[model samples]
Target chain A: MEKVIAGKPITVNEEGYLTDFNQWDEKVGEAIAAENHLSLTPRHWDVIKYLQNEQKNQVALSIRRVGKSGVVDIKELYSLFPNAPLKTATKIAGIPKPASCI
Target chain B: MKNLVILGAGTAGTMMANHLHHHLKTPEWNISIIDERDKHYYQPGFLFLPFDIYTPDDIIKTVEEFIPKEVSLIKSKIDKIVPEENKVQLTDGKQLDYDVLIIATGAKIATEETPGMEGEEWQKSVFDFYTFDGALALRNKLRDWTGGKLVVHITEMPIKCPVAPLEFAFLADSFFKNKNMRDKVEITYVTPLSGAFTKPKATEALTHLLDEKNIRIESDFAIEQVDNEKKEIIDYGGRAIPFDILVTVPTNKGDELIERSGMGDDLNYVPTNKATLQSKVYPNIFVLGDASDIPASKAGSVAHFEAEILTDNILHFVKGEPLTEAFDGHANCFIETGNDKALLIDFNYTHEPVEGSFPFPGIGPLRLLKESRMNHMGKLAFRWIYWNVLLKGTHIPFVSANMSDSGKHYEKALNE
Candidate 1:
């Protein structure tokens, strides 16, 4: 599945994210980002420090072979959106406040 | 209790917030949206603004209006993300912790990346349509300006809306014509691409429109510098393209936040699983929208698709289940070809843009890789759809997250 570049059939409900990873343009980014050198620009480093300094328990993932994905966060999501489903779905089975994501 | 903290309240973040806020358990699960700005600009409408297709009020909206009210909103600048700590530090000295952090933080315009782009002529003879002020300013210049050499240039590859430059050229031709200056203005399109676009077939189709509109094109012209004083744009080859009005698509870079995190690419984009929207450096951190390094157009539709898949996978991660969703790099865009018609192209990672029908196959209300009035209306109507359906995180009835092949002439993947 990782190697496959096939576009799968999809039917999104009323609300969803903008682009699917399968259809997003990360490779295009690699082709482009590879052309840009950050020898003088220390912006990437700033991101690493800023993102890490904020999180208390970031769950680390592997880096892409070329390192060109769009967003990078390093924290366990549990602490971030504490009110999300997998955390309390069983315990709070019947509340109707709708504070978090569906 | 679990928390889902989504960073950046742009198109991707907003949609994910709405989706999860509606689906995730309440009280026990909290969904918070964090962003730096208070106003939301209908980005796609930026393209139309310079051409007078949309008014300022039409494109501007309060960010709070589009964000789901149920989701707690944090109007603060992110100081840094301490992945090791699973928390985010705000500029205000406050702290927000998350259980599952979704980084939908999008891309940024790196105007300085190009050697001469940031020089004197910036916002003068030189301009960018990527921002609201830039677009609005260009509109005023286009309205009263007498015809001369109008150069629509692309500083490099991987900029958002690959077809936008061509659309700008096409629409400019129409704009001048409406202003009774078409015969007076000499239009030229300069790009770093080997041709009109990355895709060969679409390039051939779009290149024809350029020719038909008498729009001169300079391909393979890598930018060297912007000689703002001389009002000239020089290519790496030492060739210079002089212009009276220069509408340039400057360098596009990932957010500075990516650089702060130190987990991004040379251009400051994060490294992630191309298909999973999962962070390449952090499993719990997922990515979507213009932020990813995926090889596709950085268009609104692409973000729309990825956010859906990322939302589902985030759910799977919470359950300790393997993510089943796979993104195929599907992106679709409507290229305004002037004369009240536009071209539609739909493709994924492996497939190139091919001629076909969309939404409805044989009876497509919208054609693919072909120019038509319907597509033009579709492009115009997108502004309305973006504000009402897209930003609200509400789904369009027929459009799916994945690219449909029913009507497309799915040639064997060329760039595969």
Candidate 2:
């Protein structure tokens, strides 16, 4: 299915995960965040940027690795995304769902 | 030539296949294992799926990779087990006779037993993490979910991995806190037990963890039905607990084939001797893992321990000798307490979890009953150990099938 984000059309999987990473932008991130009832702050952007960069390198994201990434600690990451840190952060960052995620 | 047939190539059955393949000679005995599915799931990893601690690949493997070449692996669904005829009828109209039978069919989550549990809300708001699909579905729901009343519930006792629900609650607490929505989420743990856990001392320690995390507990909650339209779980006493998202451990019962065989208890678990692991009704039939009606916790650790005794007893029975080995129902589980910290609990049929160092008396690594980072690491490291060491039938260096009292501490009056 397709959803309009930031006046641009983006494709999503059956589970609502982004199907195309190239279509993602800051505006798209804002749209995703708004849907989840979250307002992305500077800290969320830091984690999102770090996650997007790590995804390019094909590294699996984990709570411990995110904490040690120097962007933010594990507690702060949880505070930013609440229930699903890697999932929400990656969703807004416009990366493919991490294979390590259920 | 004697035929030894094992049912359900799960944890207990797979381990038993390997254990016996090495012990029983080829010409004298033939061993075969049967299961409907071709995949073997690392069931403990199910708890981490919704939280993204583990992915599907990390917890699943092909069953053929684990079953040794000497043992025949039959992939077929069982229709019925005719114990009187000493044969098993398959769904495809095939039957296999067995001189010695091992029923390791294991237990399954019965979601349909409870009213409104599997209603229209199922997979939408009402979810379970017991199965692979359920965990994946819950993961999808959690991705975009805003904080609300997320209730972790247990339907009844004797479920596999009894401590898993508690682990989910702890992880949920950390999960919400990580998102800065801890204040928005109201976490409640509802159980049918009188305490936080089945045992006394462990309950005291775990109850404290719940209180420390500000998680509410509803004890002795016998759920009569789930009011899906209202999003409330109603108990037998007419007490109702409402939730926006309900994650439940549904009622667990043995495989339906056991019920068809007319050889199972009310819950479809085969009545077996707790120590010998032999079926109480049939001398030629044995039960292992979650299929057996043993008073032990239905955890992988208990199944591993039971495999040791059952393997020996099976040999003794074949040789027409007395079965001497006994199982003390040893079970050890790591309780995750969020924030990368966890607590280890070690106990058996008679003893509750206590405080002390494990494996050694004074100088040590792992601590019991106290939360520590090492325990969390140990819990994570177990995935590697399970695949490489446990399933391969290789003995872990320090751990034994039987619980030991060497390093355990007892209070002055409590000791007597």
Candidate 3:
């Protein structure tokens, strides 16, 4: 579904996660972060950039991998986005939610 | 004759051996399977073992019984795979050259990965049910013991039989009730995921069941350490959960041989063409089951499905044809929800489990996403089928490899 974010019509899934990365920009990301009650600090941006880069490389993202990413440990990740850090961060980063498969 | 070597004579390798032996004739190909152990375990029984629902003899069988007599089975510890040279080195320094290699070395629990998990409290209070020894040890503990805080936890994902931990929780509820001590036991299921399960509909259904069974859920808990002194598991987020009996499914990783060979990702899972089941680094090598970094559930049913698609892909590669991108990550699992009832889920790469009838569409004797006694019967019958049909690559009568969407409720899913 298309919703106006950052004053642009952006396509998102039911959970407000971006369906396409092509439509994502810093402004769009900032707006998404605000929705999750997070401010775009430099540290948060660094993690977001790292997540987007991993997504670009087609690497499956997980909390374990992110903790080992050197950009942010899991504790800092929780402190950054608070609840469901991976899901919330990925939402702001405009990537699909990390699939914690069955 | 050209050599086709299979590593790890587990579910995946044995099935591949059976499938290839029938197709790849002896005059043209020589098939050999290697594993260090002689005993083949029906791994699903590990869930029921702790509750005394199944005996050790029911799950344990000779590996050789299922392997085709025409195929060679070599029992040895594999050192490493020399991928470039297409050779496997044994611990004794012997090497076996192969034109085609199938890496079916499946995943196993690494209890050592977690701090204090195997510390002083190991097997006394802290336990894991992923292994046969662990299961039996837990069974003994549950025999005469009074219950307190029973934490059924998962350390990480991509674990073999992902639903086993939840099943453990459900079965625990029933077991304690049967022992006339239901109120004495406080069952708490802790997972790193946001909910009881991954898929939305299944999670919703399972969450409801957890509520009904009075099993408390502690979600999004990324465990950091098991404090033996305090008897509590502390997470990275500073959440600590105390338990009298801690049952955790530790981080599951592929065989250490994959790491030794430098052919795997961070978790020692091989990088493969998820569709074709062919190794991304080498064309002649194929990986299936928990060994490959395919985003499918690492369950026996998945391996069974992959074996079917992989068999055709291997044949195509041998005949100098393009590999078939046929594997759709199909997995069908029966979820045991305690009290002689289960919920059957059938899904694939692009689909979440939905509410519907299975195999027979509207006329199914089995229901999907709903609890039933028939599904429970299906779960019990699966053990016999695993030994008799699944290992031999025999197709189940009604169930096709690719998931059928005919009877599923997808219309409701599309809107979500």
Candidate 4:
């Protein structure tokens, strides 16, 4: 589904995670973060960049992986994005939520 | 003769050994399987062990019993796999060179990964049913214990037989009901995921079942630590759920041998070409079962399907041909949902299980995503089949290695 984010139409899934990474930008990410009541900071940007890099390289993202990524510890990640850090961060970064096989 | 060494004689390795032994015979290729353990466990039986539905004798069998006589079974602990040298070093100061290596070491619960999990109250109040010993101990504990807060928890995702913990909770409800103590126990199913399952349809069905059974669900809980003294599991989000008896599935990781070889991801799961089952770093090395970091569920049904495809791929690789047959991550599992009923789900990499018929598809017999007594019967009958047919690489009747979409109900967009 396409929704207006940062005054531009962006494709997103039902959960508001951007379906197309190409539509994602710093402005779009900030807008998404603001939706979750988070203001983008340098530390948040670093983690977002790391997540985007991992997503680009086709590495599956998880809280465990991000904690070990050295970009941000899990505690700091929770503080950065508040509740449901991975889900909120992935939404802000325009990546798919890390899913488990059912 | 060229050597093909298979590591671990568990379900995957045993099936592979049986599958390959017929195709790659004697003087051309020498097949050898190595594992430190002597007993071959019917791992699914571990779920029923705690409920006393199955005894230890029913699950434990000699590993050699399943292996073909033509293949060499090396009983030794592996120290490391030197992929660069194409050699597997044994702990007893021995090494075996292999032209082709199939690593099927599988995944195991790592209690050490979670702090306070294996602490003072390790098996007293805290228990795990993932292993034979753990299940047996839990059985003994459940025999005379007065029930209280029964927390059936999963510490992380990608655990083996993802439905087992849920089944444990379901069976627990019935078990207590049978013993006239249903009202005494408060059952809670805690998970890292947002619902009863990962898939939308299954989660909806299962979540409803949990509700019907009066089992409360605490979802999206990423556990930080288990407070042994307080008898509560604290999550990273500062959510603490108290438990009188915590039957938890700790973080499952691939064999440490993968990590020691420096050929694994963070969880020690080897990176593999999901379609071909070939190690991403080494073409000659193939990873099967839970050892590989595939998006597929780490279950016996998955390994069973993989053995069929990997067998064909191995033959193709040996003949200097491109691996054409791709494993679609087809897994057919029966989820036991208490009260002599179960839900059979057939899914692959892309497909989510929906309501339909299985094996015969449109024909009746086994239903998918809907609980039935026949499905439960199928689950029980699978034990006999696992030992007698599946381990021998015999194809199950009507069940294709690749998932069949003919009998399944799928939305047009998802049918692809």
Which candidate wins on TM-score? 4
lDDT of each residue in B269-306, candidate 4, tens digit only: 99999899999999899999999998898999999999
Ranked by lDDT, the better of candidates 1 and 4 is 4
2 versus 4: better lDDT goes to: 4
Q: Which residue pairs in candidate 2 have backbone atoms (N, alpha carbon, C) closer than 3 angstroms, thus clashing?
A: A78-B178, A78-B179, A79-B178, A79-B179, A79-B180, A81-B179, A82-B179
Give model 2's DockQ, 2 decimals: 0.01
- Report the C-alpha displacement of residue B343, candidate 4, in angstroms: 0.4
Candidate that would win on lDDT: 3
For candidate 3 chain B, the 10 contiguous residues with the lowest summed lDDT are B407-416
Model 1: CAPRI class: incorrect
Provide per-model DockQ scores.
0.02, 0.01, 0.68, 0.65
> What is the C-alpha lDDT profile of model 1 across B1-416, one tens digit per residue?
67889889998888888788877777678888899898988888888999888999998888788777778899999877888788888889998888888887888778877766867778778899999999999998887888889999987667777788889999999888888889999999997665787776787888888899999998756566889878899764467889999999987788887679776776667777878888877888888888877666788898888877877898899889998658888787999888899999987776788888988988889998898999998988888888888876777888888887787776544432
Q: Give candidate 4 misplaced runs (Cα > 4 Å).
A: B412-416
> What is the lDDT, from 0 to 100, of the residue B223 in candidate 4?
88
Pairs in steric clash, model 4? none
Candidate of highest DockQ: 3
lDDT of 2 by residue, B1-416 (tens): 88999999999899999899998867988998999998999999988899887999999998889888999999999988898889989999999999999999999999876889999899999999999999999988888898899999998776888899999999999988887889999999998776788776778889999999999999857676899899999865567999999999998999999999898876788998988888998889999999998878888888888888888898899999998658998998998899899999888877778888876765448899899999999999999988887887777778888998877776731552
Instruction: Assess candidate 1 and give its lDDT.
Output: 0.73
The clash numbers for all candidates, in the given order, read: 115, 7, 0, 0
Candidate 3: count the clashes.
0
- TM-score for each predicted model, relative to the true structure: 0.79, 0.79, 0.96, 0.97
